[model samples]
Target: MAYDLEEQEKLEALKAWWERYGTLATAVVVVVALAVAGWSGWRAYQGYRANQAMGYFEALEDAARGVNGPGGADAATRIKAASDTLRSEYAGTAYASRGVLVAAQALEEKKDYAGAQRELEWLVARKDQSTLQPVARLRLAGLLLDQKQYDQALAQLNNPPAAFAALFADRRGDILAAQGKRDDARAAWQSALAAMPANAALKQIIQLKLDALSGA
Candidate 1:
């Protein structure tokens, strides 16, 4: 009888504690469960988007290689369509930037300068940070140089990333040389040559440019 009384008291105490805290404990568990599920759902959605973007990128590459057909115009159309889809729907993905670059190159090869420029401009205008922005800007500068838009081309070279510093300087030399600014071109080439690694093959090419400028 004494043992039975002790067990009954313990049960009463547990019931009182649950009555005081059970609702709070249950709410806490529910919140944590929901957060975990939401995070998992977000990760799964990102994976799905990445896979879809990859499929389109592959299609873009295949069309660029003329795998779908023989007609040049048709190939260009397909390439443009694929690239546009990636740019519009998967702009957050790395594949979108790469797709645009490939499309730009193909269009440029076909002498579709306007179309290529438009694609490049679209990439440049994106606010999202991307490693490929420098490359796109460099290419755009080159295109502008080809068109003899001297001032506009120079604008694109501002504040390049460190790894691209030498390339930017070299292209600056090209633009200045075209403008008949021999002294400025020489200085820019000298900067590029100094920035390059000793073993870089491009070092020789830059040095040759410098030598030719000096001789001139």
Candidate 2:
């Protein structure tokens, strides 16, 4: 009977210790678990938003590319509106970058070079190391070339990403040709031809340019 009483006293002491620290331990565990869950949920929401924005931009591009009628003014206007909406809602997303390209294309077709230039400039400012950036630079250089800004066009073609090297070389050739630098133009065309795939028709075009330069 005495041993039993001693054991009960030890149990009571343990209970008191637990009562002193149990609430704090539980609160710490709950906070940590909730923090993990909240972080995961936030990441999921960001990914979902990014995907939704991409889908909407894809739809807008499809609409822009589809042929409507002889006069495409209405279609062009719709494309511009869609692109503007994307820029406003998803400005920080890759979809917004894509929308800039679409809007610039439409504006170019409409002969609104100023508007197209604005879109291209916006893209240039925001362009990163992603696929969109090189493509945007290529298009922007083309616009600059149209304005006879040879040096600016060449600057854009320089140090392009690996995926865009051939196209960049071809653009450089075009710029050089415009400047009457026949030898440099030929060299650029040859570089483009060397980089281009054997099956691509663009290689043949570059070869022809090289031959013509040699002939002259």
Candidate 3:
């Protein structure tokens, strides 16, 4: 009789403890389960997006490569189509930025300078890809220089990133020289020479340009 009574008391204690805490325990379990499920879903979505973006990038490259031959106009059209797909579906991906750059290069090769400018300008205005901005600006400045848009080219070189300082100064020299600002051009060339990497092969070319300026 004593053993039976003790067993009954233990069973009752367990029931009371469960009644007090069962709902809280159930809620914690549900929260943990949902968190784990959500994390897995997010990872899966990222993988899908990466794979899809890669496919679009591959198509873009194929189109860009095709622009070298006889049917180059058709290839350019295809490049535009692929670029549009990348921008529309994978704008957040690096592939989107790269596709636009590739399209710009193709347009430039085909002498469609206006089209190239539009593509490069779009990249410059996109705030999400901060790293590509300087490159786009540099290419755009070069285009402007080629078109004799000297002031516009200079404006793009203003306050460039440190790594591109030498290139920017070199381009500035070219623009100033074209405008007959000989003294400023010479100074800009000197700054470019000073900023350039010591071991760069282009240093020899820059030196030649500097010598020419001095002779002029």
Summed backbone clashes in each candidate are 0, 0, 0
Q: On residues 58-103, what C-alpha lDDT tens digit does candidate 1 reach at each position?
A: 9888877873346778888888999989999999999999999998
lDDT of candidate 2 vs native? 0.82
Comparing 1 and 3 by TM-score, which wins?
A: 1
Candidate 1 contains a number of clashing pairs equal to 0
Cα shift from native, residue 110, model 2 (Å):
2.4
Superposed Cα RMSD, model 3: 2.9
Ranking by TM-score: 1, 3, 2
Model 2, clash count?
Answer: 0
Residues 150-209, candidate 3: write the lDDT tens digits: 999889899978988898888888899889998999899889989987898877887898
Clash-forming residue pairs, model 2: none
**Candidate 1 clashing pairs?**
none
Residues forming the 10-long window of minimal summed lDDT in candidate 3: 1-10
Q: Tell me model 3's lDDT, rounded to 2 decimals.
A: 0.87
- Which ranges of candidate 3 are over 4 A from the true structure? 1-21
Sorted by lDDT (best first), the order is 1, 3, 2
